[model samples]
Structure formats: structure tokens, C-alpha cells
Target: MEKDKIIKYGSLTLVAIFILSTLSLLFLNSNPSVNPNNSVLQGYVIGYAKISSYDKVVKVQNPTKELEKLLEDLSKNGTIVRSFNFENELVIELKDEKDVYRLNKLFNEYNSSIFADAIIDFENLTFFDDSGKQLSIPNQRKKQKITPLFDIAEPFKIKADAIVGEVSSKEPVVYLLSISLLENEKIQIALKPKNITLISYAISLKIPWDSRSYIYDLSSKLNQSNITNKVNLANYLFFNSTPSNTSLSQLASSNIPFISKITKSTISLNNIQTKKDEINNLLSLYNINVIFPDSSIEIENLDTKNINFIEGLVSNYSNLNISIQKENLVEVEFYQESEYGSTKYVLDEDKLKVRFKTALNPNDIKNISVQAEVVGNKIKDYKIQQEQ
Candidate 1:
């Protein structure tokens, strides 16, 4: 009986140890956030070329959108490794070469329809095989020669931005404000002008920020402008909230000026600040009252459940640097680069490090490029990167 009791106790101890080891392994292996390098298309690009052309390059639709739509029409089989503007054309890199063949077939089908405006110029489109040899598309259609609708002399330009988190919205969220507004007003909040149905609907929205435009972006601009005291931000920043509803619903409903929707022949990626912003912005447009992650409400305290959403929303864009502190704490830093300088913000969610550990993908946080930083949590320090 004594031997049996000792054996049973020892067996239970071993089982407990095994369970702890398994849990540790699972915790270590689980990825919390997206990896930055996952989006970087270094090699394995089968082909690259411009799919369409426009008379006015400035009016050229963002090729990313078109490419995404084209891929969707093909039943969403391909993963877009990378896309950027080269001269007048958009160069696309795909992981699978077979996907290119399927894409060509869909383009051929488009050529036969009235939607021929975006038909693939088969002769110009290039593809490759597994051996990295340029394989001529099989039974390729004759290159369609069509005159551009409008022609204007302007150098083709493009800016690359990174997408963080999953984007499920059908219509991308874009923030466009007049450049004059930034130059003139200390604080400007503008909305995108409604799409013009008469003209081409492929027009891309001109973005105001170099990297991204967050809803809290106004605060960063104000901090950089050195006019915080000059402008009455109290009226804009503080919003009335109900005891039951801890949100600034009245502020969100306030009329914001509609800036003209300016489009350039640029491919803006489906990059957004947060899923919360994307949802709330859509809700506001349709006169929907409810929202999540509203910034206007006062937070009496912080916890993992409450603060994780806040950190995730502000951590969008590319080239962020995250450091793990001594006690397994985390500090996430975001940077935005501009002609004038770079603005950086670092958020240390106080004793709530595990939230970031789960919210951020540890592999992609370090060694990433940060264009600017949001000083402290509110855009305090303004560092000017002098032009070389």
C-alpha cells in the first residue's frame, strides 16, 4: 500500500509537469500579430507588368485595387506578393506562376466585354515558370491597341504603404484632405467627397499622409504645428458621453467638411489604421449610431481587455519597432515620415504587456522600419529628419 501511494503521487506530479510543458510550448509557438516580412516580396515573383494605361497618368486608377478586383474575379486564387508603380505601369509580383495563366484567361474574357477599358494587354504582360524561365502565355490574344481617353504630361509617381491586420471591407477607407488645408489650418478634419458616378469609377482617392492617416492623426498634426494653444481643440477633442454609453457619439456626428476626392494614377494599397476605424467610418457614413473603440470616452482604468484594442488600432502602417522590456513588457513605436520631418509615438501599456504579446506578431516587430514615431502616447516629441 505504501509503494502504491508513492507511485500514484509520483505519476500525478509527472502529469502536472507534462501539462505545464505542453502549455509553455503552445504559448511560445502561438503568433500574436502579423509579421512585417510576410508581406515583403523578396523572391519567387513569377512575372511583373502594367495591366492597363490611362491618357492622364494622374487619373490612372490605383492598380492595387484593380489587381485585387481582377484576382477576386478569378475566384481569389492568388496571393499578391507586392505591387508598385513603375513609370506609367503597375508592376505586380505573384507567388504562383499558375495563377498568372488563370489571370490571363480572365483578362481575355474581359476583352470580349464592354469592360474592355481594363482589358489586359497580352503582348505586354509577362509570366514565368517554376524554372524561372519566361514562359510565353499559351495562345495569347493579340495585343489590343486602344487610344487613351485623356493624355496629359506629368511624371508618374507612387508611394508604397503597408497594410496591418485583416481588411474585410468591400470599399477601402481613404482619408483625403486638400494640401492647402494642411498648409493653412492648424487643425483640419475633412471627409472624402462622394464618388462621381458619371465618370470612371476606378478613380483612387488621394491620401493626405505620407504613410497613413489615423483618426487621431489630427492630434499629431496639431502637435507638430505648434498651434495647440492657438486653436480651441477642447471643443473638438472632448466629447459629451452618456453614463450608459461611454462614447463621443455627438462629436462623430458633427459635420466635417467634404474635401474634393482627388485621384492620381496611383495604386493605393488597402491600408487602414484599424478595423475599428474602418467599421466606425462606414457606420458614420450610413448614419449608424453605434461604434466600438471610440477614443473620446474617458478611461478610468486600463486592463488587457480594454487596452488591447487601443494598441492594435494605432499600430498600423509599416516599419514599426517593438522592444520587449525586462519583465516581458512591450513598447510599440510607430513612425510617419514627411518632407518636413518624422513623427513617432511609443505606447507602453503599463503592466499590460501580455496584451501586446498576443496582439502583435513578435517575429515582425523587431528590425522593422519606423518612418515616424508618436512621442509618448499623444505625439509629444517632434523630431525633424533633415533632408540629405
Candidate 2:
């Protein structure tokens, strides 16, 4: 009887063990196990689908090729990881906790090896568990976000101050300058004229100074024929202004009074000014005539014949002094101190004579005078002065 009881108990124990093993296998099948190819996460698994599946999705910005490789590996392993693209961002969806944990582990391992420089950030990696809980990633690192050295508007202010501070000559009460980057990566400098009120507001908002007197002075200075003074005024207006985040091309269309010039980065404004001064000095020293055309010359008052005569005469000499004594007549006197001998030229089929004579002055300066009165395309009265 004792041997029979022992056998019965052993048989019952074996039967119980079989039932428990079968149930365990069924439970495992219901909650799929992920083979993450990792020894540390060997037993880690996902639970069966409940009311809620994925708590949250993972998002990545500016993803690199390594991220693609990681997803490809999981797809090759028969894991269903769905990915959706949204403009610059990539959204990844995992089936359950098992898949999330699997991907998370694989990503960390691959990221450490492939992205040692942290170029592709692991900080963008976010994971969640099956129970609708956020999972913290392991071996995660933080990256420093980059920012601009100065404000966008601050550069314009700084450049304006620097321009104003370098004024060696006359300083305008108010000036404005702007700089912008060109499409070819070149820098464009613009000198713009603004209202005195604008300058007033810029200098002191509390007490807006009436800079009308200064503006009048600047206007009068600009009206003069001196290129040196004009350039100085341009510098005053150009450097004492503001900068803009707007493009240079757009500002050009507004019809605002401004002088813009393109230059290289290696040359400073002071250097530019010095170079211009040196050029002017050289021209003066050599007595070289540089003719700059005037767009504002009025020819409305003169008759066609006089205009033609003046045009013909002026074209002969670049350094001629034009004197319009009357509407019908004009005189052009050009000093050719270096040239000798007499020369003749024809204006509209009218012959003109030139004479060279010594001046009565003590310097013994020779005068070459060309006096002519044409009568029906014929030379009548002509005088030429030569050195004594």
C-alpha cells in the first residue's frame, strides 16, 4: 500500500508540472519576445496587447544614415517598426514595449560606435514602455544648442557707431548706413540720407534735437562741385546709419536717396578714404584732368544752335571752363599751358582759328586764345596767343 501511494503522488506531481509549462508557453506566445541581438536584454519582453498599446512615438530631426541602418536591421529581423515622414522630422512607431526596448538598446550601442563625435544626437531618442509609461534611455548624453554671437540688429548699430567714430573731417548731425550680404557672399555698403527727425529719434528719444541747421549745412555742402566734400558728406551719411536684416536688392527698389558701393572684406573704410585721398593728391600733383559728367546740367534755356555749338566746343577739351553769358551765345575757355603752337578746328562746318601769345604778367606765361565768329560756315574773327 505504501509503494502504491508513493507512485501515485509522483505521477500527480509530473502532471502538474506539464500543465504549468504549457500555460507558460501560451503566455509567451501572446506577448511576443524580441530578439534584440543583445545578451544583456535576453529575457526582456513585451506584454500582450491591452487597451492601450503605444503611449508615445519617437521623433527625430535631421536624421542621418546611421538611423536608417538601425531601422533596417530591425525590419530584417521581422520586427514591424512603422516610420512616417513629416517634412524635416521623422516619426517612428514601435509595436509594444519589447520592440521599443529592443530598438532603444540597439540604438545606444550603434550610436556609441558609429557616432562617437555625437554628430547624430542620441538626445533625440525617446522611448516608452507597453504600460503607457515613458522609458528613460540608457547611456544617453546631452548636446549644447548653438546660438548667434550677437543679435541681428546689433551688428547694424555697431557698424554705424564705428563709422561715426572714425569721422576725421566734418560730421553731419545725422547719418545712416546699411550693410547686407549679397547672394555671392560679398558685402554691400550703402550710405543713405534720412530726415533730421530720424536722426533725432536715434540719438535721444526723450529730447529730439531739431537738426534743421545741420541738415541745411549738409545740403549746402552737397550742392558744391567739390568731389572731396561730396565724398565726405557721403561718408557722414553712410557710416552714421543703421543696419538691416532685409536684403540689399529690396532696399534699392524703394527709391530712397542712397549711395551704395561694393567692396572687399580686406579693405577698411579708413583705408578706402585714404586711397581716395591719395588718388586725388596724385591727380592734382600731375595736373591731370578727370572729367566727371553732370546729369543735372540744364539745356532747356539754350537754343538748338547754341547747344550744338557748346557741345562741339566742350568735346574738344575735357578741362574747359563753360560760361553761358546769354541764351544765344556761350564761351568755353580751356587752358592748355603745356601745349605749344596754333591749332584749328571746325564746328558744324564753321572754321575756327587759334592764336598763341605771351601774357603781360610777370610770370611770362604764354596764352593760347582761340576767338572765332562764324558767318555762314566761314571763319571771320580768330585770335591765337602763344608764349613770348
Candidate 3:
């Protein structure tokens, strides 16, 4: 009897273990955890949906409370939310990749359409998962893939016209016009004048101060052109602003007033002689002959010795009048004279101080030439006056 009871208890324990294992398997299938590849399904929430120009709303119904809540949250985030039950579809428009990924993950985890027996439609849109991996659905209405509006070989052109009123306000009244080529066809857009303000606002946000002035100037020109189209304004502001390789010839042809003011402040030299000497010294350092003298003074040749003679003279005579002349040869002239009536007998004791100017070149000096004659107590002045 004891052996039989032990056997019965062991059999019951084995049966209970089998039942628990089966329940675990069923639960795993019903609520599966995210896989490594499908990890993007986590931490994302629906943002919103937008209906394109080609899209039409047939009917909207939100049966699942979860989907309804998701749509409400997305609508608050500036997305156009649309739901249609007759077509058995839930369409959500997203602002950016972040929102698109969020909604995609929610749909994957909830198996949204599978549970609701509805279809998920992404109209005129594309999506990427959290890892930047593309998510493609099978057996859905084919979305028309829009090639970028502008071609790779062309860039968007911008043009505007405006009239400046005599009012105190700085705002420029504008008239805007724009045209774009799509699928090798030209499309003209019309924009109202008020939209010009929006374009200005966007320009101020994106462009620097200097560039912003150009855009503002364009706005003023637009206001003056008498443009009555609002669609043109939107196209020029948003579509043209994006990166493109489209030809902007038409946009460039529009005339706009752009003014650039460059103010330059002038600096005047207080002492002309000092400035001339300084400039000569700089020139001499480059092995260039800039100074030629009217008279002769025996000094070390600068070309042979590479010695700076003008720099030494300026250092010695701080108030020396240094003049530069360009004739058959460059000349540096200097002179100083004293007036006197008293006479001394000794020629050497005459106490005559002769001031002479010297000319030197980086090349060989063949002979010295003096153009002025010196009288008693006076040296001839051959100073060449330079225009300031």
C-alpha cells in the first residue's frame, strides 16, 4: 500500500509539469517579445498623418481605443490625422523620421491591422525604422514615389520685387512670382502678398544677417511687382529653399532690388616726410632702390654691403625731409641751409655747414650727378615736391 501511494503522487506531479509547459508556450506565441531585428518596434509612438493634394477622405472611423489615443496624441504634435473605416485603413501623417519610426514601431508591436481586421495605408510617404532600416509592407496600394522636385543638375532660383511706401514701418510690401518644372513640364504658382511675410520670416531664421538683408530686399521688390499669387510664394519660399540641382534661370530673371553698403574710413598721415621715409625703408629691405639724391655724399654702397642706409639716416635725423624721385634713375634728395651775414677770414673757419642728400641703388653706381649750384652760405635746393 505504501509503494502504490508514492507512485500515485509522482504521476500527479508529472502531469502538473506538462500542463504548465503547454500554458507557457501559448502565452509566448500570443505576446511575443521584440526580436533583435524588430527592436525598432519599441519606444515609438504615432505622431500624425497628412493628406496630399491627390488624397481624398472617404470615411473615418476609430474603433480601437488604442489607435484613437494614438491619433489624438499625434494630432497635438502638428500632424494631420485621418482615419477611414470603410476602407478598413488607419492613415497617420508624420512630420519627420522620428515620428514615422515611432508610429511604425507601434504598428508592429500591436499588429494594428491584424487585430482590428483593418489595413494600414501610407499615402505618398516613406518610412525608416529606428536603426534607419527601411520598413516595407506587402500587398498595399502602391504609393507614387515622387522624385525630388528639383533635378540634381539644377538648383532653385529665387527672385522678388517690392515697393517701399513712405510709411515709417521697415516692412516691405511685396509681390512674389514663381515657376517650377515638373516631369519636363512648367508649372506656374500664384501667391498672395501676405505670404511674403512668411518667406521673410523663414529667410531670417535660415540665412545670416548680411544674407538676410538681400532676402528682405527681394521681399520689398516683390511687393512692388503687383503679384497676386499665394501658391507662388509658398513654392518659392519652401521648395526653392531646399537643396536642389534644378536650373534657377526663371527665378533669376525676376528683377529684385539688392543694395550692399560698404563704408571705408580713411586714415590721414600727420607727418608726410616720416611716412615717405618709412615706406622707403620698407622698400629698401626688399633690395629695391626708392631714394635718389639731388647732390652727392660719400657713403658706404648699400648694394655691395647690403647695409640699410635710409634706416640709419632716419634714426640719426628724426626731423629730416626725405624725398624720393623717379627720373632716369631713382633719387633721394635732402638739404638744410643756414642764413648769415658775418664773415671769417679762414676758409676752414668759415663755419659753413654743408647739408647734402645722397642717392644709393642696389645696382653699381657709375658716377654722381648734382643738378643745383651752391652759393655762399646757401646750398641749392632741388627738392621735388610730392602730391599728397
Candidate 4:
């Protein structure tokens, strides 16, 4: 009877351990709040080239109605990325590169009138034409410094020491990421312009999984002359929620009874773009979001639930349906890159990140942070144009 009791207790103990281990993988004590708007393209901005011809020659009779229209229109989607007005000529940088082409065409059509000649270039603040003709602006560039600051709760700051109790990105996930907005969290970054300013900025995020995949970016610009040169978190950081905590490979391995099926479903990519649309579609379907200035992808499905959707895609690359068997390696590494020290390890399934940057001429540019935080990256393109 004692032996039987011991055996029963031992069984119960084992079960308790198993439950705890599983709970560790599935839950967390806290989480960051996610904003649904533009989460995937967080901190992303459009790029455009400027066409130069007229300086302050043609003044805006009413700067409020006409010019402000462009600024207000920016809230929707398309907005001018860069622009400048000098005594010699007026140059405008647009968000979409497509707009640059269209404007250049218009410039040529009206070159004989007052435009002189419209030459399109990626750089802004350009003056001289190729033929040594001068389009001089009397006041070249008035320089000043605009430091953007923020107001937030404790641990966050205009300047502060390393925060305590907060986990580092490098830490492994013992529990599914917390989905709670930390209290006392808010952020602000800004540039106050006294006069006309050409702004270029890119926001960046450190992927909780890895640092090498940092090039993914979303760019934005400041085209307005005196409008505080600021962007709210809404301008750049966008996400509905955090990504999934478990990787496809991890889920497949843990859930599939057949090891072979799990192995087959985790095929690698020759080009990340090949399945861009499909992958992107899956991301949306699963409530995934893409946050930037540092490049990272996020997804929002719980484990084991969406394995079939991915498994089908892997088996048949050409078709919408199928599973894997092409490769023969029994012990293959699914994501070799993860072996390196990446912040986006397994626990980041619920992971999300966002970045912010600011570039203006004096065309010099870059981040301050907080919860619902705003960060910065200084833009260099406009500065390059100034030097040239």
C-alpha cells in the first residue's frame, strides 16, 4: 500500500512538472500594448526625388490654403518627403518616387514659362545646372539646432540609466510575450523649425530575435517650413498586436506525430521575395504586423493552430496546396541564422518593435524612446545634396 501511494504521488509530481513547463512556453506575466494602425509598416516613410527650376521667384500668395493642403493631405497617404525654397529656386521632395517622375514631366511642359528647366535628382537643395548656370538663393541655408524631447513615466526619460526589472531583447522567452501596455509609458520625438526645413528621417527597431536583419526600413520626411517638425507614434510605429511566440519549425516539431512531416514543412528561401505576397497574406490573415526602422516581421497566431496553413504552402511551392520531402538531410537546421545571438529567439512569438528617425537640412539628422514610444534616425540624403 505504501509503494502504491508512492507511485501515485510520483505520477502526480511528474504531471505537475509537465504542466508547468508547458505553461512557461504559453504564458507571460506582462505584454506591450499594440496599436492596430499601420503596424506592419511602422516607422516607414515613402521616398521621392525633387525637381528644381523656380526659387522663391513664384511666391505663394496664400501659403495657408494651398500649401497647407499638401501638409494636411499627408495624414491619408501621399505627402511630399523633401522640399526647399531659396531665392533662386523652389525644390520639392515627394514621398512616392512615382510623383517625382510625374512632376519632372510637368516641369518640362512648363519649363519655358517660369520653371526655367526641371531637372529631377534624388538630392534636394541643389542650385547650379550642369551647364554652369547659377540659380543662386540669396539666403543659402540658415542653420540652427532643434532637439526633440519627450514626456513619459518613470524609467523612460529625456536621459536616464538602464531600466531595472525590464527584460532585455537578448533574453530567451520562458513565457509567451505579455500583451499588456506597461503603465507610465509614453514617448515623444520632435524637430522645431524656425523657417523652411528639409526633413529626412528613418525609424529603427531592434528585432528581439536578431540584429543582422536590420536593413528593413520605412522612411518619412518633413516638407513643411515651420510646423514643429514632429511626428507622433502614429506617424511611424504601427501594429495591431505582437507576433506569434513560437516559430513554424518549433510548432511543427512539437505538434506533428510524424517527424518527417515537420522536417518537410520548414523549407528555406532562395529569395525572401519569392513568396512575399503569399507570406504577407498569411501575415495579415493571422493578424501579423511589420514594425521598422530595423527590419523584423511579426505574426499573431497561437501555436499548433496554423500549422496546416503553412505546411500546405511548403510542400507545393508552385501550387497553393502540398507538404515537404525534397531534401534528404535528417538532421537539418531550419533557421541557421538563429544560432547566432539574435534578440528574436523563440520567446518573441508575441514580439513587436518600432523605430523613428529625423533628418533636416542643416540637412543633418536620428531617437528618444518611451512606451507608446517615439525614437529617431537622422536622414542623410538631404545633407548629401547640401554638401554637393
| Regions more than 4 Å wrong, model 4 | 1-78, 112-388
Q: lDDT, candidate 3, residue 213?
A: 25
lDDT of 1 by residue, 1-388 (tens): 1210111010000000000000010111013253423422111111112223211111112345555476455334535444444334443444444444444454444541111111112122222323444434223211221111111111111112211111111222222222223344443322221111211112222332111222233323434655443222222211111112222111110121111111111111122334445544543564434322222211222344534543453344223222112111222222222111121223233311111212333222222111222322232222211110
The lDDT of model 1 is 0.25
Give the range of the ten consecutive residues with the poorest summed lDDT in model 3: 10-19
If ranked by lDDT, best first, what sequence of candidates would result?
Answer: 3, 2, 1, 4
Q: Candidate 2 clashing pairs?
A: 176-241, 177-241, 354-384, 355-384, 355-385, 356-384, 356-385, 356-386, 357-385, 357-386
Best candidate according to TM-score: 3
Q: How far does residue 32 in candidate 3 sit from its true spot (Å)?
A: 54
**By descending TM-score, how would the candidates be arranged?**
3, 1, 2, 4
Quality of model 2 by C-alpha lDDT: 0.26
Query: TM-score of the candidate numbered 1?
Result: 0.16
Each prediction's Cα RMSD?
29.5, 34.0, 34.1, 29.9
TM-score of every prediction relative to native: 0.16, 0.15, 0.19, 0.15
lDDT for each candidate structure: 0.25, 0.26, 0.26, 0.23
Query: Residue 162: error of model 1 in Å?
Result: 24
